[model samples]
Target: MKHEFHWSQYLDTNHQKFLSDFKEFLSIPSISTLPEHKEDIRRAAHWLSNKLSTCGLENVEILETDGHPVVYADWVHANNAPTVLLYGHYDVQPVDPIDTWDTPPFEPALKNGYIYARGANDMKGNVLLLIHACESYLETTGKLPVNVKFLIEGEEELMSPSLPKWLEENRGRLTCDFIANADAGQTDKRFPTIVTAVKGALGVTIDVITGPSDLHSGLAGGIVHNALHIMSELISSFHDKDTKISITGFYDDVLEPTKEERELCAQVPFNHDENIKRMFGVRDLIHEDNYTPAEVTWFRPNLAVHGLWGGFQGSGFKTIIPCEAHAKLSIRLVANQDPSDIFDKLERHIHEHIPTGVKVTVSEFGVGAKAYTLSESHPALRAADEALKSEMKAAPVHVRMGAAIPILATFKAILGVDVVTMGFGNGGNIHAPNEHQNLAMCYLGARTYARFFELLGTDGPVDH
Candidate 1:
């Protein structure tokens, strides 16, 4: 099979150009969830289409979906070579509460060796790293080692609603041997890591209505069923004193963490006290008898109340009893757990705890996705391990993310391919304010991707 020649020289020569291109890409505010920025999202897709075309990818086009357009590009160089599909999102989350930002979110300021922007860490940085890797091969050798495809979507933040439909419609063109997603976070700043598995998520909204309208608390508080109390009671049942989720049958499908996996988790350097203090401003860790905080996050199921709304909250305390209360709850599911089954059990559990005279309504906002794990023995995994070890000068660790990436399941189900989730960027204030990506990781990530492709090109399995 043909492979790219002199790829490293090209990367070294065009390093400055690559950084400039990334800055320009980050300048576009492709926030997909907001309707006002629809054109901006399309503009980002067009920009990526042009970049892919410049990198020598064939069949490049912006295919419009129900929501945002998907940029599809591929090169069918050799029929015998393995086809790798690359997936990432150009769209970013809405930079709300914009006043809190020290520097403008969309301005793309480089301060303290870090890029300060809304999508800097969450995705755009990683996207550019992958693009540069492809560019390196093309600039040096004129062709790729393997047939490659790029599927950069614009609706990942909004639950990726259009992705499934788009994938179904264009199933024929998306056939590939394996997928690689450069959209996840690294294990830490000191060590290079590959996230082989991602946990799933399920969201539900529960509402309780007790009376027709607000009533006088002094008179009705004693006799009437309180909607707030009922909602609280139902929410409280989803957890125990150990903080482990209590939804019936929630763990029935959960695949226990293997001994090797647990050992891998133990290898990750963690300071629970510092982590808690840095994250939640807490003094000590909480919950569970046998498990540590890291284990709870990576190996177990968790239920969290995302949002709760009910009574008044203006200036002073209101004496009136509210007629209704609502709460938005979400569950993070682990490996082997079925999201649909978990949602059903949660609904049933809520109904069993409903208080009389208060009508409880349960609406599932979204269902969770199952976690994913790649075989450690796979050749691609080994290649990834070698690439990271060479680049970082330390053996990379294998880790699992607590967060869910729904596309993992979609890729596995639709294309029948396991993805190599390797990227740089640590989880620090990811979705929250002050989100930032490490500047050093940016270079390391690019090097890793370049080396990964080089390794795969030279020694990757030829059977597939």
Candidate 2:
């Protein structure tokens, strides 16, 4: 039986309505980190709930948490049909330095074939695309091909503090045959793609206190130990001369990519020169030997010094050794690496290198482990490939992300199923000023998701 939802036909008919509704959503300024915007976040969650209910989803409600609400909806009628848990975030990063944007971030200007807004790509736009897909299915066929559920959260940007607990408490309600996360980037400006693996992360802050108070460098330069210099030495110890991460046992649990995985990654087009030119850099990327840029980003562990601060930054130098200095460091871990074990090892490494004269303290932030990956031969990958081929007239590429999505790992542990991460959007100053998402991809994503439902319904459960 050929189950077809002619989504394009309805999309053509309702393009204007879609754009208008999306603009309204983008205007909400649902920044999760700010306390003043708490009501705005709730308003966004309710808006999503209303949209889901209007699309004929049953049991729609805003599930409240300690921080923000989670909008959940489902339509699970078909006993044999596969259930898909679609995941996305309604929260967006705070728009600081608002002066840098040409148009107001909340206003959502459409220009140059893209939509420019705070959450355009990072990821309210993608969330709306999924909703639009469900609407099209309901309008065209009066029913969906498979069971669908949406788990949209309002605190994804604020470290997702509430999600893990929410999932643990509502495990029975969130169960599904598979999950689809629409929060990643595409292969390029052209081809659609699926992310098979995402890296884990651990963040730690190191502080060095040298003296009781800031002392004049000219008066006590030789007497006091400089906290800034001590902190710098500790930071330098984490990297070798070749720029490889030197933290002990960092790679002990890393699972190497198979020979076939390497071949597939190599086949993906990567012009190193083009990347360098885009970044305005004069040198190539530094990494361990025998690995491509894609491999370094997806298959390897990395340590990065995210921030450093000490003292004296006015118009001129304050001649002081400073009382204290501090730095924030983050590590991106690959598959099989435990975040707690990594954090312990890193703290030990820092302690070994601490200068004798300076007192040091270490603090650990949120720790998240890497997610398990399905093989390239998995049925979900095949269905995604077929869907992209049919909808976009192109073969989809398989890739991995260097960042961690703790929710993905949570779903794996609690629900006992691997997820399919297929979405559209390109990485371009995403967390920085002037963030944008391609209009074509936004529209194409909705069409692709509609096609995915049709394909999944026909193909049945994805064989491991």
Candidate 3:
């Protein structure tokens, strides 16, 4: 506690400079999905590596991935202490629909106690906080209570394609007892939160072809099957009248929420109709009759068709039967479900339902991760609760999020460790335009992470 309080003093002395440095970090426009921003992504990685080295962490380096580079650093002087892997991402989602932003997405601006910029809250903000927390400890006491390592990757928005191989290759170097992910968000601005579970993701592409080329509808209407129609029919087959997934074996591995989990889920606040209007701008949500809206999103899997393309649209009617059609699907998986098995079942179902005149192909992409859940009694979570309560003066809430953090599962499968997903960012507007983070939460987060490092390193839980 003495060293932690000393670390807080370091944070206090450098508070303004930390804010200024973070704004500069947010201005790089490290959009991973865009090819033109490759340099920007590399710049962000270099910037992070430099900060880690300057922060007095040992072995700070930028390691190359097939795509973007990963920034690695650590302090392992605390022999026999638990090693905590701090995980985060520097890459941000593309700022599409550019006109929607109030300010330039890459130009960080401070207004009304918030920083408005791309990657400001989604992850980069927390990344900075974690780094500063480490810096605080090293600057004050010249060491940490626990061994700490940072694995800040640049391809998280792209589902972290290079991480699995990287993790396997560097398992010994990156070994840790548990991970602390700063990529999560709080339940509300007034209350901190710890994510107990995260749904996994599987991405697939569907392609259909009815002929070699397009043909005039007048000539092809009765003779040939339309690829668009075939694709539409195929998409329809994925769901039934009750909106449940129609694919066989889709729910075979799903773990039913325990009674305790159900109770915790029930305590999470909700206003179904208000959520539909505020978050989705929709009149209704589709689901089975037996479950609450929260259960449907958090405890169950849901599939969505992100894009559908086939015919022409050039402000004029082009009467042609398109020869090709395609759709991109993203499926969310809950605990105990395997992405590979679901993809295999889906591919088989698509092949079985192909029309007579059309051919269909299904391709699975990326090394997907399985869903994960941590026990309520996990020590890291208990440490997180204590840290959050100390920082916010309020107990944190526990919830399972619908979104997937692929690396959480990777840390578990490869390192045999659970991840404590403690959050300081807000939930809304992460990937959207005008994305921002509350500066006040940033301060609280720095204090908590600093305290958490101490708690994890101690022989037993540190008294609050």
In candidate 3, stretches whose alpha carbon ends up further than 4 angstroms from where it belongs are 1-5, 270-283, 459-464
Query: For residues 128-245, could you state the per-residue lDDT of candidate 3 as single tens digits?
Result: 9999998898887888888889999999998899988888989899877788899887646455778888989998999999989999999889788888988899899999999899
- lDDT comparison, 1 vs 3, better candidate: 3
Give TM per candidate: 0.91, 0.92, 0.92
lDDT of 1 by residue, 1-464 (tens): 22445777666666678767777887898998789999999889999889888877789999989889999998767445567788888998877678888877777777777777778888888888888887777776777777778898998776677888788888899988788888887756567788887877777888889889989899998788777877877778878877877877887887777787667777687534475466666677775667767777778888889788887879988888888999987787887888888888988888889876778888865335666777776668877888888888888888778777877887777777788898776545566666677777787788788888767777744332
Question: Alpha carbon lDDT of residue 437, candidate 1?
Answer: 74
Measured with C-alpha atoms, the lDDT of residue 1 in candidate 1 is 29
Estimate, for each residue in 1-464, the C-alpha lDDT of model 2 and write its tens digit.
Answer: 22264767876567777787788898898999889999999989988888888877889999998779999998887557788899999989888788888888889888888788888888888898889888887877777887899999987775577888888899899878789889887746455678887877777888899878998899888787888988888889998887677888877988889998777776666434356345434465666777766678768888898789997878966788888998987788887888889888898898888867768999976545555565666676777788888878877787777777767887888788788888786545576677888877777778888888888888876543
Q: Which 10 consecutive positions of candidate 2 have the poorest summed lDDT?
A: 271-280
Stretches of candidate 2 off by over 4 Å are 1-5, 97-99, 271-283, 314-317, 461-464
Residue 178 in model 3: shift from native, Å? 1.1
Q: What is the C-alpha RMSD of each candidate to the true structure, in Å?
A: 3.0, 3.0, 3.0
C-alpha lDDT of candidate 1 relative to the true structure: 0.78
Best by the lDDT measure:
3
